[model samples]
Target: MVKKVIRIILLNIFSLFPLDSRKIIFESNSEIKDNSKALFLKILDLGVNSKYKIIWPVENPKECKDAFKEYKNVSFVKKSKSGSSSLLFLYHCCTAKYCFYTHNPLGQRTREGQRKVFLTHGTPIKDTRGMFWPPYENTDIISTSEFAAYLRCKTFGGGDDVVRLLGFPRNDFLFKTDKGTEEYFDKIKKSKFIIWLPTFKRHNISVKRRDFDEDKNSDISILSPGFMEKLNNYLKAKDILLLIKYHPSQNLDYVSLKSYSNIITLTNDQLEKNNVDLYSLMGKSDALITDFSSVYIDYLLVNKPIGFELGDYKSYKNGRGFIVDNPLDFMPGEKIKSPGDLYTFIDNIFSGVDKYEEERIKLRNKMHKYVDGDSSERVLRYFELIN
Candidate 1:
C-alpha cells in the first residue's frame, strides 16, 4: 500500500515534464522477441524510425546488446526488479508518449496524453486464472477478430472497449514476403518443414508467471527412448524436416537435437542474432504442430495445415483449464493423441492432405477480421504517429 502510493506520487511528479510526442517505449517478457521485436522491425521497415525514437527495455542489456548488435537506432535500458536501472525504466514510462508492452508495466496508470498498447504475447484459449491485465484507462489490448476480441477480454479481464480487433504485428510476417528472411533461411527452405510448438506447462519466470499442477512430460509417451531417432528417420525418408522452437519459459535440458539430420531446434538467441522472427519461417513452412498454443490461431491466416497433439489434454484442462469445455472440438487440425496419430499427421503433410482446410478457413474467418498484414500500421495510425 505504501509503496504503491509512493510510486504514484513519483509518476505524477515525473509527469510534470512534457512527454515527447515522438518517443515510444517497448518492454517484452521475452527480452526482445514476441510482438515487441515484430513491431520494432515493422517500424524500421516503414521508415518510422526516422521520425520517432524507440526505447526497448530489457532485463539483460549485455546479452541483448550482443544479440542485436546490428541495430543502432533504438536505445536499450536495463529493466529489472530493483536498482538504478529499474528507476530509469519507470522514468521512461512516465515521459514517453507511447508505451507498447507484452507484460503489464505497473506502478502507475497511463498518464494523461500517454497511450499504452498491450501487444499481447498470444491469442489464448486457456481460461484466466493468474492473468494480469494492464491498467484499463488510455490502454488498448490487441486481438484478432470479433470472436478473438471477446476471448481476449474474457481471458484477460477487460471491457470490450479496452480490446481492439487490430491483428498482432507478429502475424504480419505471414501475409508478406521478405527477401532478407527468405535468403536467411535458404537452406532450411529446401525440404518440407513443419514447425512444432509446445506450450510450456510451467512458466519459469519471476514476472507474471503461473504454476500449474503439471507433471505432464511427453518424453515418456511421445518422446520415449528411441522417439526422436524414429521420427527423424521417417521425416528423412519423405525429404521433410521438423523445426522445433520450444517456449522460452519451458525448462528443458537439450542434449543432441542436431544429431538428427531431419530435425532442427531454434532458440530466441538464434532468431535475435539473425534479426528474424519465427512467424517469418511459419509463413513458408509446410505445416504447424502444436498443443494448446495460440500460434496456431495466427497460423490460421496462412491457411496451412496444422496438427494438434492432445496427449496431455485432460491433464492440462484439469490444471490450466480453457475457455471452452471441449477445446479439441474447436481445433481445426489433425487430432494427434498418440504416436500413431502423429505419424498419420506427418503422412498427411507428406501427401499434401490438409484435412482441416475447410474448418481452418471457417475458424480463420471467425478469428481474424483483417488478413491484409497491416496490424502494425493500424496501431501506428491509431496513435496518429503515422499518416
Candidate 2:
C-alpha cells in the first residue's frame, strides 16, 4: 500500500512537468530485450533520433547501456522497483512524449500527455497469469495479425482501444539481411542451422489457474544424455547445427546440458553479452523446433520447416490449458513424439522435403494479414512518425 501510494504521488508529481515531445523512453521487464528493444532499434535505424532523446530504464543500467553503446542517442537509467521509479526513471517516463514497453515495469502510468504503447512480449498460447487481466487494458498493444489482435483483446482483456494490428516490430528483424547478421550466421560451425525454443511451464506444478490442473503434471524432460548424444551424432553427420534457446523463466540447471559435437545452448545472458539480435539470427536459421512457445508463431514468416516436440502434450494441456481449444489445429508443422520422430523431422529438413508446407502457408495466411517484412514501417506510418 505504501509503495503504491509513493508511486502514484511520484507519477502525478512528474506529470506536472511538461512532457518532452522529442523524448522517447523504452522499457521491458527490466531486461534490455523483447519487442521494446526491437522498436527502439527501429527508431534508431530510421536515422531520425539525431535530435530525439532516447532513454531506457532498466534494472542494470550498465548492461543495457553496453548492449546498445554504438548508438549515441541512447541512455539508460535505473528502473523503478516496487513503486520507486528511482526518481531518475520516473522523470524520464513522465517526461517522454512516447513510450514503448513490453512489461509495465514502471508499474504506474504518467500518461498525462505521453503516448504509451505496449509491445507485449509474445503471443499467449497457454493460460499464463501475466498474459491476461489488468495493465493491458486501455493501453495501445501491438499485434501481428487480425487473429492475434483478437486473441490479445480476449486474453489481455482490453477494449478496441488497446489493439494496433500493425504487426510486431521484432518480426521485422527476421526479414532483414545485413552484413552484421550475415557475420553472425557465418560463425556457426555447421552448414545448416536449426533452433529449438521451449516455453516456460511454471504453472505445470500443482498450480492455480481457472480450469487448469491442480495436480502435479508429468515431467517433460525429453533431453536425456543418451538422446542428446544420439541426436548430436545425427546432426554431426548431417552437417546441421541445433541451437536451443531456453526461456528465461525455465531453469537450465535442470536440463543437465552438456557440450555436444553439433548442438549448442543459448541463454539470454550469452545473447546480451554478444549484443546479438535474436530475431535476426532466427531469420537466417534453416528450421525451427519448438514446444508451445510463441516464437514458433513468428517463425511462420520464415516459411520453413517447423517441428513440435510435444512429449508431454496431455499433461501440459491438462496442467496449463491452451488459449485455443484445438492447439494442434494452429500447429502447422511436424509433430515429434520420440527420438525417431525428431530424427525424421531433421532428415526431412536436410532432404528439402517439407510435409507441412501447404498447412504452414494456409495457417500463415490465416494468421498474418501481411506477409511482407515491413511491419515496423507499418507501425511507424500508423503513428505518422514516418512518411
Candidate 3:
C-alpha cells in the first residue's frame, strides 16, 4: 500500500514537469539524430491536406524540426524544462483532437481524447513484452501486424475492439515501385548488400541506453571489444557492403570501420543519398542478419535468408524484452547463440546452402498482407483524407 502511494506521488511529480525535462534528463548522449522525426516528416508529406496539426515533442528536436519544412501547419513545440514527455502526451490528449504516435508505453489517456493513431516505429522481436504496446484498460491500438495485434490481446490482455491491425506506414515505400523499390533494386542488382540491422537489446546493443543504464550492465554485455572485433572481421571477409543501421540512440563509431571498402554507415540524413527508405534496404539486401529487430519480418517480403543472433538472448530477455508469439518461431536461417556461432552463420550465408528463401517468402506473406504501397494512403484516409 505504501509502495503504491509512493508510485502515485512520483507520477504526480513527473506530471508537474515539462515534457523535455523528462526526456532531456534521461535520454542518453549517443543520439545521432531523431529517426522518428524523419519518419514523421514522411507522414506529414502524405497527410499535407489534413488540418489536424501534427505535434512532435522530442528532447533533441533539431533533426526532426526540419521534417515539417514542406508543410506550413505542422508544429514542432519543444516541451519546457518542467514538462515530462509522458505527461506532455497525457496533456495533449485533452487538447489535440487527433494524434499520431509511435512509442509511448504511458499513453493511457488517449482513449478519452479525440484519437491517437500509432505507427509502429521500430522493428519488434520475438521475446518483447508489455512495454512495446501496453494493454491499457481503455485505449485504441494501431498495430503493424496481425501478429502484433494478437500478441497485444493475448500477452498484455488488451481487448479485440482496442486493437487495429493496420500495416506499418513506413513500409509503404517497400511496396511502391517509385517510392523506394526501383532505386533499391537498382543498387542490389549491382552488388551483394547485407544490411546488419540488430535490435536495441543489450545483447545486441539495440535497446535505448537510458533503460540499460538503469540496470547498470547487470545482465547484458553491450558492445565489447570482442564484439567489435567480430564485426570488423565480418566487414573484411566479404565483398558484400554492410549497411549498419543503429537504433536512434545507439552511437557506433562507424568511422572506425569505414577504412574497409565493404562497410558503410547509414544515418538518418544518409537516407537522401540513394533515396533509400529503410524497408527498401531490407527488400533489396541479399541476406538479412539481425539480433531481434523485426525488420526481418519486413525483409522476408524479398524472400531472402533471415539470420538470428541470439548470443545473449537469455540475458536480453532478462533485461530488456522480446515481442513474438514464440521467440524461436520467427528466427529463419540460423539461431546463433555465441560469438563463434555468429562467425559460422556469416560463413554459411556466404558459402553454405542458401535455402531460407522459401520460408522467408511464406512467412512474409502470412505476416504482411497489405504491402500494396497504399499503407500511407490508408493511414491518411483513416484520419479522413481524399486519397
Candidate 4:
C-alpha cells in the first residue's frame, strides 16, 4: 500500500510537467517484438508524415539498434526493473500523448488527455481469466474485428464504444508482400514447408509428465523416437522441411532436434536474426499444424491447409476450458490425435486432397469482416481523429 501511494504521488508529480504530443510509446508482450512491433513498423513504413517520435522500451537495446538505426524518429531505451532507469521509463509512459500496447501497462494509468490503444496480442479461444471482468480502466480503445469485439464485450464486459472493428494491425502484412519478405519466402520455398505451432501448457508436475509421455509418441513432439524417424524419412523423401515454432512459454530444448536435417526448430532469436515476422512465416508456409492455438485463426487469412494435433485435447480442455460452446466445432482444420493420423493428414494435404478447404474459408469469412490489408491505415486514421 505504501508503494502504491508512492507511485501515485510520483505520477502526479510527473504530470505537472509538459507532455509531448509528438511522442508515441509502444510495447508488445512486454518484449521488443510481437503484434505491437509489427504494427509500429508498418506505421513507420507507411511514411505517415507525422512528426511524432516513437519510444520503444526493450530489454536489449542492442538487439533492435541495428534494425531501427535508420529511423531518425525512433528511440530505443533500456528497460530496467527498479532504479533511475525505471523512473525514466515511467516518465516516458506518463508523458507520451499516445501509447499502443498488447498487454496492460505496468504501474501506469491512462491520463485524462492521453490516448491508450490496446492492440491485443491475439484472439482468445480459451476461457481466460478476467475475460468476463470489466475492461481495464486505462484502455481507451481496443483494436479488434467486429465479431471479436462483440464477443469481447458480451463475454468480457467492456463498453461497445471502445472496440474498434478495424482488423488487427499485425495482420496487415499477410495481404501484402515486399522484396525482403519475397527473399525470405524464396529461401524457404525451395522445399515444401510446414509450420507446427502449439499453445503452451502450464509448467506443473502433471503437465510436465504429460508432455514427456506425449513427446514419446504424440504428434505434438517431432522428436518422439519412432515418430521422429518416420517423420524425418517422410520429409526427406518428399523434400519437405518441418519447422517447429514453440510458444514462448514452452521450455522444450529444440536445439537437440538439430541432428535431423529435415526437422528445424525456429526460435524467437532465429526469427529476429533472419528479420522474419511470424505472420510472414505463416504466409510463406504451405501448411500449418497446431493444437488449440489462436495462430490458426490468423493463418486462415492466408487460405492455406491447416491441421490440428489435439493429442491432449481432453486434458487441455479440462485445465483451461474453451469459451466457445463446442471447441471441436470451432476448429476449421483436420484434427489428428496421434502421429499416424498426422502423417496421413500431411500426405493428403500434400497430394492436393484437402477436405477442409471449404470449411476453412467459411470460418475465415465468419471471423474476419475485412480481409483487406488496410488495418494499419485504419488504426492511423483513428489516431488522426483524436489528434
- Which regions of candidate 1 fall more than 4 Å away from where they truly are? 1-9, 62-73, 81-85, 134-138, 177-180, 206-214, 217-221, 254-259
Model 1, residue 14: what's the lDDT? Answer: 80
Those runs of model 3 whose alpha carbons end farther than 4 Å from true positions after fitting are 1-47, 60-67, 80-93, 105-113, 122-134, 137-139, 176-190, 203-238, 251-259, 265-277, 317-326, 337-353
| lDDT (10s digit) by residue, model 2, range 1-387 | 988788678878987888788887888767667887677767888865776888888787897677678887888988643333578888887788778877673323636556778777777666664544474333577887778777666676555566778878788888886565577667874888898887754423323433324322322367787778888999999999998877776545555446687898877777655656788888888999998888888889889989998886777788757888899988989888988889999899889988898999988776777887788778777766677
> Between candidates 1 and 4, which one is better according to lDDT?
1
Whole-structure CA lDDT of model 3 = 0.53
What is residue 261's positional error in candidate 2, in angstroms? 1.1
Cα lDDT of model 1 by residue, 81-186, tens digit: 3423456667788888888887655224747777777888887788864467533643777788888888877775665787777789888888765665677678
| Residues 11-110 of candidate 4: C-alpha lDDT, one tens digit per residue | 8878776778888888764466666776687767875424778888777667677777877788777774232245666777788888887765632464
Q: When superposed on Cα atoms, how far off is each prediction in RMSD?
A: 3.0, 3.1, 7.3, 3.8
User: Ten-residue segment with the worst summed lDDT in candidate 1?
Assistant: 211-220
Model 3 lDDT, residue 328, Cα: 75
Q: What C-alpha lDDT values do all the predictions have? A: 0.75, 0.75, 0.53, 0.70
Better of 2 and 4 by lDDT: 2
Candidate 3 local lDDT, 94-142, one digit each (tens): 3554445555433324234345444445445543454444455335555
TM-scores for all candidates: the values are: 0.89, 0.90, 0.68, 0.87
**Clash number by candidate, in order:** 0, 0, 17, 0
**Per-residue lDDT value at 297 in model 1:** 91
